[model samples]
Target: MSETAREAILTRIRTGLAQPAPLPPRPDFTAPVHPPLAGDDEVLAFAQSFQGAGGEFYYCETRAQLAVQLATFRERQQLGRPFVWEPAMQEILRAAGVAFQADETEFLAHADWGLTSCEALVARTGSVLVSAASASGRRLSIYPDQHVVLARPSQVVAEIGDALRVMQQRYGTALPSMVSLTTGPSRTADIEKTLVLGAHGPRRISLFLLEDE
Candidate 1:
């Protein structure tokens, strides 16, 4: 084609492209549902359903109870499963033969456990959110084969929004690098119609609820 004709064709193409594409419809975001905290007993019951599906649970009232829990947890770890906890509980786990490491790299390779302080627990969803600023690195929860969390009943709330609000209030200026809301073990149904657990994260999750002595 001649230079003038080619130039004209290019200008037309540019103009057509500049006209802008039509926008798709917006998704609906409004819905009525109960908050996480609204149904405490029911949610706890639901969480319990996940038990024995390659998971465990413990309730404690004292340091001695903690010891017993650790004993059982240690047995699970010896069987090639991993666990997670809060740094505050490190000494107990250490006594139980579970190694403690601060760095995620070390923890992922050598340690079968991780420790993290949670921001809040949502009873409605049986979910807990771990802030990155907490002693337990975010990766600790997701990278292990099993997750063990320590949370007080008082820390459990009704909804996810309540947890977010607590985080905003507690950390007024600085927010955590990441906040993870984990309800159960890592799972996927992507493989040929079979539901598989622990695909991208922990295959099991256990919660230790400690009552004040």
Candidate 2:
């Protein structure tokens, strides 16, 4: 329009801007969006959700049990020798009388079963949060045909958000360059809408929940 109409609009806008508008109340970011599960309930929820996502769940009440269960699983599945680079996991494997090759070259050549430790486990979505910060880095969880994660009960959380918070506290300002959540075996339904597992990564993902305080 006209200059008169534009002036009138400008004057109205100026008058409106003279008065401050009330701001909406701030949200409580600390509050969880969903109800949180705790203790054994949280672990149980994770087991159920993880299994629903086509993940194998093994609950070991003691470290000895974890070792024996893992040894038996490896034998039964014929997974060959596992490749673990994490020092803690290597120690566990050694204690369990499990043979694992830690050489990167050997792992790359024979990537059969890869064992790793996870950052956190989400009970809500049954997702395992892993970071490149670990000695195993990124490949151990994805390259192997059979990927096994050894997690402690203390690492289980109620939801993804909770897991993220825990990670933040653990890592502080120097967070990992790469962080990923593996819900289960890599899957996709891209071809003719047919579901396919191991489409982009490991075909099988197993979680060994070691009951450690």
Candidate 3:
């Protein structure tokens, strides 16, 4: 308020601004934050972690076996023909003698199940990394009541970092607009602390592991 007081405050501020503050140390991005998974048991580890998160895991020794397992699962579950959009997945279904719906309008109206392929499977956290870059896009993995993921053993990674690196390398500089990691079926405990499944996404998620390697 006083002229002398203002002058003294300005001088103090000038003195404080004379020296630059020291910057914090940079982190090592090369080293992983968590311990990397060891050995050749990534599939086993993924299966364990995935099942622990309420996901169903089926290991198919071959594509033929995968077809049989898929057909059996469909019949056992009494589910209608699943909605599949990806051309690769459509071919696999057609070759396997499995009927699927590919119509977008029909899918939006009524679809009991949907089939998709993930970008990568994290062995440590049992999370499936999906992106809009794939043909499945966003809806197929979320809209259906039951979501089935077709994955190969080679796609399983040691950790989340490894999965992210795989995506980055695959896409290079042109990355996808949206990338998501789904751990399990959608669930929420927000309503009166009652856990309800399928609140935000598919109620059931099944992973069919095809042993191509």
Candidate 4:
């Protein structure tokens, strides 16, 4: 059929059937809002949820204690080498006398441990949200044998909804290309219903929750 004839017929058909339909005034989506509790309530919920999902959590101070904690983890796991975000964590590790790789790609390929910061912690699900546009990118969130996150108590929100709000506020319209909500080490029970962890991603996920200020 000729392009002009096809266009004319399609236009006539569309006009014949078209009607202005106003969407039913978007029903009031507002529901009973129960805001998340602050202080220990949210913290406890997050800890319980994260632990239940096979994630390990730890406490750490900024300088000395943080260094000691990392050292202990390395000795215990025998991590081949560490890969960390440059300005965010590499300097801190160096100041603590720990060695790390700078070339993220090469390091990620060989390193067993990968360290980065999180955007926020979802207390309801005990998950950490991260953006690839952040210093670590999505690779730091998933492409490693072990994932270590430095989380502050202030970053913990009552639920995933709150955490997402924080992200939206921070990035505005230009958001990261990738955002990951990780609850624990990867897992799967697809084969014969036998549960297996780290089937798709990191085998180990650890969060060092900094003491509340």
What TM-score does prediction 1 earn?
0.68
Each model's lDDT comes to 0.67, 0.89, 0.89, 0.81
Assess every candidate by TM-score. 0.68, 0.81, 0.82, 0.78
Candidate 3 has what TM-score? 0.82
Q: Best-fitting candidate, measured by TM-score?
A: 3
The predicted structure with the larger TM-score, 1 or 2, is 2
lDDT (10s digit) by residue, model 4, range 96-171: 7877776666763586878888889988788988888767777776878899987788898887788889989999
Model 1 off-target regions past 4 Å? 1-32, 35-55, 77-87, 91-106
Model 4 bad stretches (over 4 Å) = 1-29, 32-40
Candidate 2 local lDDT, 141-162, one digit each (tens): 8899989999998898887888
> What is the TM-score ranking, best to worst?
3, 2, 4, 1
* lDDT per residue (tens digit) for residues 1-213 in model 1: 999999999999999899977899886677546433334474364345435344465777776776677667777567433434455666655654554554445565654554455778765566778877865666777776677777676776666777899999999878888888886788889879799988888887877776643
**Residue 141: error of model 1 in Å?**
1.1
Candidate order, lDDT descending: 3, 2, 4, 1
lDDT of 2: 0.89
Model number with the top lDDT: 3
User: Looking at model 1, how many pairs of residues clash?
Assistant: 11
Q: Once model 1 is optimally superposed onto the true structure by TM-score, how far is the C-alpha of residue 109 displaced, in angstroms?
A: 2.8
